[model samples]
Target: MSITPDKAQRIAALAKLAISPDQAIRLAAQMDDILGYMDTLNSLDTSGVEPMYTPVEHVSVLRPDVMRQDISRADLLRNAPETNGESFVVPRII
Candidate 1:
């Protein structure tokens, strides 16, 4: 899997990236190495291995939802610096 500078430039353009000619050349070589490694991995034998949905074991630690009494509006508004007996007052915006 040889990646040319032209191919690297095109890939960068598709990804909305700007790279110099020297950078493109460097990126092409790096991409080629990565693809070569992928090819090497593809040659492995895994006939007896079980298919995995995820790489790590996942456990849901969600706590049980418990209903509780709601606080009164007066109690909530008590800490407000400025209020109109219902809601907090702030400088008006345009």
Candidate 2:
């Protein structure tokens, strides 16, 4: 998982970041360490462990959907700038 300065430079280019040669050298070393640590973590066994999406428990706070007709279709159509006695007429984009 060793990171070379050239690889670091390429990584920086991909991220749209500009770095000097000295910065690239430093970045290579830092990235090497990070990758080494990730390799160590990957060596662990978690066969029986359950996968979790988040560390904390979460609950839905959304309101339930209900069907109700408050406004009539003719009333809604009357407010439109342009319509063929149906939906609002919008400018063609495609």
Report the lDDT tens digits of candidate 2 across residue range 1-94: 5799999999999999999999999999999998888887678898999998787676866777988899988899997899888788899979
Q: Write one digit per residue (lDDT tens) for candidate 1, span 21-84.
A: 9999999999999998889867889899999988767686778799775998899899999999
lDDT of each: 0.91, 0.90
TM-score of 2: 0.51
Instruction: Flag clash pairs in model 1.
Output: none
- Span of ten consecutive residues with least summed lDDT in model 1: 55-64
